[model samples]
Target: MTKAEETRTRIIQQAADLFNQQGYAGASMSDIMAATGLKKGGIYNHFASKDELAIAAFDFALEQVQKRYVRAVKGKRGSIARLKAIIYTFATAPDEVTVKGGCPLLNTAVESDDAHPVLRERAQRGMYQWRRMVHKVVQSGIDSGELQPTVNPDTVATILIATLEGSLMLTQLYGDRIHLQRAEQHLEQYVDSLQHVDNLKQQESSSR
Candidate 1:
C-alpha cells in the first residue's frame, strides 16, 4: 500500500485500540495523537473530528470482531459446528485476547446508546450483522437436517445473540470468567437440543 494509505490505516488501528480501551467519551484527540505519534494536523488530515474518529474507530474495531468470528467458523462443515465454534472461541479463548475491554459490540452499545448517534447506528449495524449470521447458521442447520425443522431462526438467533452479549457484559462487569463459561455451556446444551438424537449421540460419543 501507498504511504498515505498506510498512515490512514495506522491511525485507524490506533484509534480502534484506544476506543476499545477507553470509551468514546473517555478517549481523546491527545490520547490518539500520543498513541499514534501523529500531530493533531496529521490526524486531522485523516479524520476531521473526534466524532468522526469515534465512528471510524468503532467500525474498525467491530470489523475486527466480525472478521475474528468469521475466521473461527470458516471451513467448519455444519452450521451447528460453526455456531458451536463461535461460542467456544468466545467462551474459552485465552484471557489475554477476549478479556480486555470486553466485546466491542457490547462496549459500543453501552457507551454510545444515549450519547453518540452515529456510533449508536454503527453499533446497531454490528448487532444486526451478528444476529443475521446466527440466523443464517440456524436456518442452514435446519436445511441440512442438523436441527429440528420447527425451530424459529429469527427468534433463536436474536435470543442467542442477546444472551451471549448479556453474559459477556456480566462477566466483564463482575470480573468473573464463570459467566462466560456458563453461557457457553447453556448455549451448547441449547444447540444440542436442536440436533437429532442420533447426531447428538454421535457428538457425545465423539467427545468421549
Candidate 2:
C-alpha cells in the first residue's frame, strides 16, 4: 500500500478503538490526534471532518469484528455448527479482547442513537446484514433437513442476535463473563432444539 493509504488505515484503526471506548461525542479531534499521533492538518488531509472520520472508523471496527466472525466459522460444517461457532466466537472474540470494551456494532448503535445519523445508519445496516446472515444459515439447515421444517429462520435470527447483544451488554456492565457464557449455552440449546429428530436422537445416544 502507498504511504498515504497506510496512514489512512492506521488512522481508521486507531480512531475505531477510540470511538469504541469513548462514544462519538466523547472523543474529540485532539483525542483522535493523540490516538493517531497525527497533527490536525494530517487528520484533515485524510478526513474532511470528525463526522467523516467517525464513519470510516466505525466501518473499520465493524469490518474487523466481521472478519473475526468469518474466521471463527470458517471450516465448520453444517449450519448448526456454524451458528454455534458464531455464538462461541462472540463470547470470546479477539477484537473484544483487544478493545476491552464490547462489540463495536453494539457500542456504535447505543452511542449513535438519535444522533450521528450516518454512523447510526451504518450500525443499523450492520445489524440487518447480520440478521440476514443468520437467517440464511438457519434456512439452509432446514433445506438440508438438518433442522426442523417448522423452524422460522427469521425468528431464530432475531432471537440469536437479540440474546447475544443483550448478553454482551449485561456482561460488560457487570464485568462478568458468565453472562456471555450463559448466553452461549442458551443459544447452543436453541440451535440444538432445531435439530432434526434423528440428529437429536443420535446426539443423545452418543452422549450416553
Candidate 3:
C-alpha cells in the first residue's frame, strides 16, 4: 500500500482501539490524533470529522470480528459444535486476554443508538450480521439432523444475539466475569438442546 494509505490504516486502528475503550461520545478526534500522533489537519485530511472516523473505525473493528470470530463456525458440522466454538472464541479472544474493552459492537450500540444515528446504523448492521451468523449455525444443525425439526433458526438466533450482547454489557458495567460466564452457560444449554438425546451419547463417545 502507499505510505499515505498505510498511515490512514494506522489512524483507523488507533481510533478503533480508543473507540472501543471510550465509546463514540467519549473518544474525540483529538484523542484519535493523540493516539496516532497526528495533528488536526492531518486527521481531517483522512476523515472529514470524528463522526466519519468513528463510522470507519467501527467498520474496521467489525471486519476484524467477522474475520476472526464469525469465520470460525463457517461450514462446520453440527450446529452445537458451531455455536460452542463461537462462544468459546468470544470467551478466549486475543484482545479479551490482553485488554478490558469488551465487544466493540455492543459498546457502539449502547452509546450510539439514541445519540449518533450514523454510528448507530453501522452498529445495527453489525448486530444483524451477528444474528445472521447464529441463524446459519442453527439452520445447519437442522439440515444436518443434529437439532429438532421444529426449531426456528431465526428466533433462536435472535435470542442468542440479544443475550450475548446484554450479558457483555453487564459484564462491562458491573466489572464481573460471572455475567459473561452465565451467558455462555445459556448458550451451552441451547447447544445441548440441539443434539438428539439418542445420538448425544454416541456423539459424546466417538472421539474418546
Candidate 4:
C-alpha cells in the first residue's frame, strides 16, 4: 500500500486499541497523538475530526471481534457445535484474541449509551450483526432437526449474547476468568439441551 494508506491504517489500529481501553470520551486527542506518535496536524490530515476517527476506530475494533467469531465457527457443522464454539471463543478470548481492553460491543454499548449517538448507533448495528449470526446458527439447527423445532432462534440468540456479554463484564470487572468460565459451562449445557429429544434418543440408542 501507499504511504498515506499505511499511515491511516496505523492510526486506526492505534486509536482502536486506545479507545477500546480508555473509551471515546476518556481518550483525548493528545492520548491518541501519544499512542500513534503523531501530531495533531498529522492525525487530522487523515481523519477530519475526532468524531470521525472514533467511528473509524470503533469499526476497526468491531471488525476484529467479528473475525474472531467467524473463525470460532469455521468448518464447524451443526448448530450446537457452532454455538458452542462461539461460547468457547468468548470464554477464551481474554487470553486468545481480543481488542486489548474487552469486547467492543459491551464496552461501546455501556460508554456510548447516552453520550455518543454515532457510536451508540454503531454499537447497535454491531450487536444486530452478532445476534443475527447466532440466530442463523440456531435456525439452521432447527431446520436440520438437530435442535427442537419449537425453539425460537431470536430468543436463543438473545440468551446466548446476554449471558456471554454479562459474564464478560463480570470477568473484566473482577479480573477473574471464573465468571466467564461458569457462563461458558452454562451456555454449553444450554446449547446441548436445545438438541431435539429424538436426536438425543437416537444417539443414546446408537451408543447401546
Strongest candidate by TM-score: 4
CA-lDDT, candidates in order = 0.82, 0.88, 0.79, 0.94
Task: Report the number of clashing residue pairs per model.
Answer: 0, 0, 0, 0
Candidate 1: misplaced stretches above 4 Å?
Answer: 93-100, 197-208
- Residue pairs whose backbone atoms clash in candidate 3: none
**Candidate 3, which segments miss by more than 4 Å at Cα?**
94-100, 201-208
Model 3 lDDT tens row, 71-135: 67767667787888888777556335322266888787778866788888888888888888888
Q: How accurate is candidate 3 locally (lDDT)?
A: 0.79
Residue 199 lDDT in candidate 3: 64
Candidate ranking (TM-score, best to worst): 4, 2, 1, 3
Query: Where does the lowest 10-residue lDDT sum fall in candidate 2?
Result: 93-102
Tens digits of per-residue lDDT for model 1, 1-208 = 9998899888888888788878889888889899899999999998888888877777777877777788889999987888898888777643536324668888888888667888888888998998899899989988887888888889888768877888888887898888888999999888878886667777889999
lDDT tens per residue, model 4, 105-189: 9999999966699999999999999999999999999999999999999999999999999999999899999999999999999
lDDT of 2 by residue, 72-184 (tens): 77898999999999898887763356453578888988888676889889999999888988998899999998999999999999899999999989888887878888999
Q: What TM-score would you give candidate 2 relative to the actual structure?
A: 0.93
Worst 10 residues of 4 by lDDT: 91-100
Error of 4 at 168 (Å): 0.8
User: What lDDT is obtained when candidate 1 is compared to the true structure?
Assistant: 0.82
Q: What's the best-to-worst order under lDDT?
A: 4, 2, 1, 3
